[model samples]
Structure formats: C-alpha cells, structure tokens
Target: MSERVLIAGCGDLGQRVAQLLLARGDEVYALRRHPPALNNSSIHWLCADVARAETLSNLPAGITQLIYLPTPGGREEEAYRSVFVDGLQHMLAALTESPLRRVLFVSSSAVYGEHGDEWVDERTPPAPLGFNGKVLLEAEQWLSTQPVRSVVLRLAGLYGPGRMQLIERLRAGLVHAPRGHWANRIHVDDAASAIAHLVELREPQALYLGVDDTPLPLNELYGSLAALIGAPAVPEGPAPAGLGSKRLSNARLHASGFRVRWPDARAGYAKLLDTQ
Candidate 1:
C-alpha cells in the first residue's frame, strides 16, 4: 500500500524526503508556513503554524508516516521550545486519531553535548549543554511514550549544495578551524536518502547516529575543502580544552546496510567544487 506521508516543518531536508517518496508514488503533504513553489506540483502543500494547536486542523488525514524537521525560529530557549517542543506536542495531539505509524525525528548530535575525543553512538546518554539540545531531548523523550514508533537520527554537521557557509567562509579567507576538534558531517542527499531507506525497512531501529564514515579533524577538513575549492588554506586556532570535540559512530547505520553516496567530506564537497 502506498503511504500518505505528511512532512511537518518541511524545509530543504523535508523537501528532499518528499522527492524520494514522490518517486515511489507515495502521496506527499508538506506543512510549512510558506511552502516555496515546488518543481513537483504533485506534492500537496498546506500552510499552518505548528506551534499553534488551533492551526493544526489544516493537516491532512490518514498520514501513515511523518518526518518532523522543524527549523528553529530563533536561537533562544523560548524559540527552540516553541518549535521543537510545543510545536511537536501540537502535531502529536492533532494526529491522535490518525493512522500515523511512525515518525522520523531529525534531531541533532548537539544533544550528546561535548564528549571530547570519546566516540558517541545511540547508546551514549544525551547530556545537552544548550537549551536547543534540551528542547530536542525533551521532544525525543516525549515521543518515546507516544503510541507511534519513533526513529531518532542524531545527525552531525549537515552540508550540501546551497548550504555552503563553510565553503564561502573558506573563500573569504582568514577562516580557522579548532586545531584538533573533530568534525562530523552528512551530505544533504544522504540524510534524505537515509530517511527513505528507513521508511522502506520492514522494521527500522529506534535510534541511529546519522553520520558518515569519516570524522576528520576540523582543521584537516577545512584544509582539504579549501584546497578543493582553490581557496587559501585557513589558519588553525588552538583546540579548546574539553569542548565540542566528540566523534560520532555510524556503525549502526552501516549495520543496517544503508550506504551513503558521499561517505566523507572530500567526496561530498568535491562534487560541489566540480560543479562550481
């Protein structure tokens, strides 16, 4: 049976997921405040504010699967809570009577805090440092007690075409990476494809670390990227004492037989460079 997939907070990542579903002939409903003009007119776009429960009635019926990837309205706690927590709560309540089967929450590795050189997997207990992480943790915990199954993917630095702040920074010159801190990443396409793969799985796992095979040193990553884009090498700043220097493990992601086209920064960023 084809799914009625509803994408809440459907932004760039959500739109990518929608494309994958559309290719499989699944119905797509995108809920965004102002959904951009889509190339695929087949996708049904609904405009509503997720934080407000009263606006949720605009949501479609019989949503079998949902992808919650809300963008934070701001960096403050109130902003984070409004979208990640309260918004999520409103969404869940609205779907109470629907046939929603499972939800794939696009969470962040920030929830794990700073593990320094330690390797973090799904087994690592979340100890968030900031309110943004706190909000995500609260939502993840709340989702666990819900009727529907939840698959939480703690993605690392998400990068791809158009999302090129790092590349642009390198071009601007004088960019610096923390001397020894580790940097983790996932290509935008891979992130979207992973969600599609999990959706197709007969039994998807509860938690998966959404990262690639390589967790390169920050300076090394920037250096390679700078070289690829023909930008000047960035200076390296001192690695801070016990900061965000953690490495994420994608062992579980690999165990599930999911393969990313660009498994490392070099392969992923090279494509962008070649296209430019």
Candidate 2:
C-alpha cells in the first residue's frame, strides 16, 4: 500500500522530500501557512500553521508518516519555542486521529553546545549554549515521550541551491572564521534524502545526526570558498557566538546504507558556484 505522508511546516526542504516520496509512488500532503500556487496533481497542498492549533483542525485523515521541520520567524527564545515546541504539540494534536506510523522531526546540531576540538556524536550529552538549541532540545525531548514512533535528525548547517549567504559574504571579502574553528554542513538535498531514507527504514533508530561525511575547519572552508570564487583572502575572526567548535560524525547515518551526493563543502560550493 502507498504510504500517506504529511509534511508539516512544508518549505523548500519539505518540497524536495515531497518530490522524492512522490517519485516512489507515495501520497504526499504538504502543509504550510501560505502554500504556493502550483497546480500539480501529485501533491496535495493544505493550508495551516503548526504554531496555531485552531488552524490545523481540518487536516486529512489516515496519514501514515509525518515530517516536522518548522522554521522560526525570529531569533528570540519565544519564537523558537512557539515554532519548535508549541507548533509540534499543535500539529500532533491535530493528527490524533490519523494512523501515523512514523514521525521525522528535523532538529539542529546546536543541541550539542560547544565542544572545542572534540568530536561529538549521538551519544554525547547535549548542552545547548543558546536559546535556539535549548528550545530544539526541549522539543526533541517532548516528542520522545509521546506515544508515537518518532525519529529525531539533528542536522548540521544546511547549504545548497539558493542558500548562498556564505558565498556572498566570501565574495564581498566580509567573511571570516577563527583559526581553528570547525564547521559541519549537509547539503539541503542530502538532508531531504536522509529524511526519506529514515522514513522508509523498518527498524530505524530514535536519533541520528544528519550531516555529510566531511567536517572541515571553519578557516579551511572559508579559504576554499574564497579561492573558488576568486575572492580576496578571508580574514581571521572569532568563532561563531554560542556555537562552539566541534566535529560532527555521520557514521551511523552511513552505516544505515544511505549515502550523500555532496560529501564535502568545497565540492558542494564549487558545483553551486559554477552556475554563477
């Protein structure tokens, strides 16, 4: 039987995941506040905000799977909680009657505070240094206690098509990084693919780190990107505030038989810059 999937907080990444699911003959339902005006027959678009429970009363029934990836509107703590915590609560409540088999909650690697030069994995204890991480951690914990099958994917920084803020910064000679700070990222497409892979896994683990195979130093990444775009040399700057330097491992994700298309940031950025 084709699985009925509900993508809560559907956005760019959600749409990519929807495409993958649709290609494999699964029923895809996309939910968002202001849906696009595409007249596609494959995807069913629903209008609702996960942060507001009242707006989600009319969701479709018999949804076999769900993907929750809500983006906050602001950087404040309340904003994070409202979207990640409250929004998830409201969405789950709305889907109470649906036969949900698995839920994929997209989280962030920020949950593992600063780790200096250490390598962190799923077994490492989380000590989020900022409200963003704190709020996400809360949501993950809350979802774990629910009486539903759920998987938490703590993703690294996402970069892919149309997400060129870093490249732009490097081009303008305004980008800098600490001498020894480490960086981790997963292409947006890989993130979507990981979600699709986990959704279909019969015996999936409760948690997994969604990152690529490579974890580069911040300075190295900046330098490579600068050279790739023929930009001026990147300057040395302080590490990102609240995000401590640490290496993230994707060993578990790889062992699960899923591979990423872009494993290194240099290669990913090079491919993206080619079109410019």
Highest lDDT, which number? 2
Please, what is the TM-score per model? 0.95, 0.98
Tell me model 1's lDDT, rounded to 2 decimals: 0.86
Candidate 2, run of 10 with poorest lDDT: 34-43
Error of 2 at 210 (Å): 0.8
Q: Give the CA lDDT, 0 to 100, for residue 191 in model 2.
A: 97
Residue pairs with colliding backbones in model 2 are none
Off by over 4 Å in 2: none
Give the clashing residue pairs of candidate 1, or none: none
Compared with the true structure, all predictions reach lDDT values of 0.86, 0.92
Off by over 4 Å in 1: 37-39, 238-243
| Clash totals in order | 0, 0
Model 2 residue 132 distance off true place after TM-score fit, in angstroms: 0.5
Candidate 2 lDDT, 61-106, residue by residue in tens: 8999999997788899998998899999998998899999888999
- The RMSD of every model to the true structure, in order and in angstroms, is 1.8, 0.9
Residue 206 lDDT, candidate 2, scale 0-100: 94
Report the C-alpha displacement of residue 17, candidate 2, in angstroms. 0.4
